[model samples]
Target: MSTGQGRLIIVVTVCVAMLLAILPMPDWARPFRPPWVTLVLIYWAIALPHRVGVGSGFVAGIVLDVLTGALLGQHALAMSVVVFIAIQLHQRIRVFPFWQQSLGILVLLIVEHLFGLWITGATRGTAPALQYWAGPFIGALLWPWTFVTLRKVRRHFKVT
Candidate 1:
C-alpha cells in the first residue's frame, strides 16, 4: 500500500485498541482484561517492522496512558520493552507456524505484564494475586485470532 494509506490503517487500529484498553470490565473480569494496545503493537511491529518500532510503541503507550488515566510512561516503558523484544525476534518469529508465533506472543505478553507490575509496584502498588498474572494467558489465547485478523487487515490495505 501507499505509505499514507498504511499510516492511516495504523492510526485507525491504534485508536480502536486505545478504546479497548479503557473500556470498563466487571470486577470479576477486570483482571483478565488483556493489554489491547500491547497486542496491537506486537502484531504491527512483527508485520511491518519498518513502520512500527520503539517510537511507535512509545507513542502508542503514551496515548494508552492518557486513555487509561495512568501515570505517564507506565505503558510507554512496558510497551517500549515489548516492542524491542518483538523486533529483535521478528525475523525468526515470523517464520514460525501460527501456533509457535502465539507461543512467542505469550512470552512477550508475560514479560510485558511483569514489567508493568514492577512499575506499578514502584510507582503505586501492585496486587499480589493470580488475577494480576492472568491477562497474559488470555492474551496468548487470543493471539491466533488477533494475528489472523490483523494479517487480513494488512492484506486488505496492501500494507508492506
Candidate 2:
C-alpha cells in the first residue's frame, strides 16, 4: 500500500478502537468492556514498532482522554508506557503462540490499568471499585480474536 494508505488504515483502526472504548453499555456490562484502545495500540506497537511506538500511543491516548473525559494525561501516560513495553518486546511477542501472546497481552493490560489506578488514586484520593479491574481480563480473553482480525487487515491492506 501507499504510505498514505497505510497511515490511513492505522488511524482508522485506532479511531474505531477509541469509539468502541467509549460506546455505552448496560451498568452490569460496563466493567466488562474490554480496553479496546489499549488492545489496538498493543497490536500496532508489536506489528509495526517503527511506525507506531510511544508517540503514537500518547497521541491516541490523549484523544481517548478527551473523548472519555478522563484526567488530561492519564490515558496518555498509561498508553505510552504500554506501547513502550510492547515495542521493546515486539520480537519476542511476535514469536509467541496465540495463548502465550494472550498472556503477554494480559500483562500489558494489567500494567496499563495499574497506571490508571495510580493516577486516579493520587489525583482523586480514592480508587475505583473491584469492577474496574475486570477490563484487563476481558481484553486478554479477547486478544486472540483481536490479533487475528488485525493481522488479516494488515495483510489485506499491505500495511507495511
Candidate 3:
C-alpha cells in the first residue's frame, strides 16, 4: 500500500477499536470488556512502529477519555504505557508466536491496569478492585484472534 493509504487504514482501525471499547455492553459483561483499542494500537505500534507511536496512543486515549467521560488522561496514560512497552519490545515481540504474543499482551495489559489503578487511587480516593484486572486478562485471551483478524483486514485492504 502507498504510505497515505496505509496511514488511513491505521487511523480507521484505531477509531473503530476505540468505538468498540466504549460501546455500552451489558453490565455483567462490562467487567470482562477487553481493552480492544489498546490491544489494536499496541499491535500496530509493534508491527508498524513507523505508523503508530506514543503520539497516536496519547491521542486515542484522550479521545477515549472524552467519549467515555472519564478523567482526561486516564485512558491516555494507560495507553501511553502500553504503546511504550510495545515499542520498546517490538523486536522480540514481533517474532513471538500468537500465544506468546498474547502472553506479552497480557503483561502489557496488566501493567496498564496497574498504572490505571495507581492513578485512580491517587486521584479518586478509591481502592482498586480485583475486577479491575479482569479486562486485561480477557483482552489477552482475545489477542490471538484479534491479531490474526486484524492482520487479515490489513491485508484485505491492501495495507502494508
Candidate 4:
C-alpha cells in the first residue's frame, strides 16, 4: 500500500475506536466499558512504534477528551504516558505470547487510568467509586482478541 493509504488505515482505526469509546451504554454497563481508544493506541504503538508514538497518543487523547466532554488534556496526558511506555518496550512486548502480552497491556491500562484518576481527583476534589477502575481490567481481558483482530486488519491492508 502507498504511504498515504497506510496512514489512512491507522487513522480510520483510531476513529472507530474513539466512536466505540463514546458509544452509549446502560448505566449498569457504563463502568465496564473498555477503554477502546487506549486499546487501539496501544496496539498501534506496539505494532508500529515509529509511526504511532507519543504524538499520536496525545492527539487521540485530545480527540477523545473532546468527544467525551472530559476535562481537556486529561486523556491526552494519560495516553501520551501509556504510548511512551509501549514504545519503549515494544520490542520485548512483540516477542511475548498473547497471555503475557495481555499482562503487559493490563499494566499500561492501569497506568493510563491512574493518570486519569489523579486528574479527576485534582479537578473535582472527589474520588470516583471503585467501579471506576473496572474499565482497565476489562480492557486487559479483551486485549488478546483486540490484538488478533487488529493484526489481521493490518495484514489485510498491508499497513506498514
Residue-by-residue lDDT tens digits, candidate 4, 1-160: 9989999999999999988988899989998899999999999999998799899999999999999999999999999999999999999999999989999999999999999889999999999899989988899999999999999999999998
> Candidate 3 lDDT, tens digit per residue, 1-160?
6889888888888889888987899987887888988989988988788778898999998999898888899989988878988999999988999889989999999988887888889998997667878988899999988888888987888776
TM-score computed on alpha carbons, candidate 4: 0.99
By TM-score, the better pick of 1 and 4 is 4
Candidates sorted by lDDT, best first: 2, 4, 1, 3
Q: Provide the overall lDDT of each model, using Cα atoms, as 2-decimal numbers.
A: 0.88, 0.95, 0.88, 0.94
lDDT of 3 at 123: 92
Backbone clashes in each candidate structure, one number apiece?
A: 1, 0, 0, 0
Write candidate 1's Cα lDDT for 37-117 as tens digits: 888899999988999989999998888888788889988988999999999999998999988888899999999888778
TM-score of each: 0.95, 0.98, 0.94, 0.99
Candidate 4 off by > 4 Å: none
TM-score of 3: 0.94
- By lDDT, the better pick of 1 and 2 is 2
Residues 41-156 of candidate 2: C-alpha lDDT, one tens digit per residue: 99999999989989999999899999999999999999999999999999999999998999999999999999999999999999999999899999999999999999999999
Residue 56 of model 2 has an lDDT of 94
Candidate 1 global lDDT: 0.88
Over 4 Å off in model 3, which ranges? none
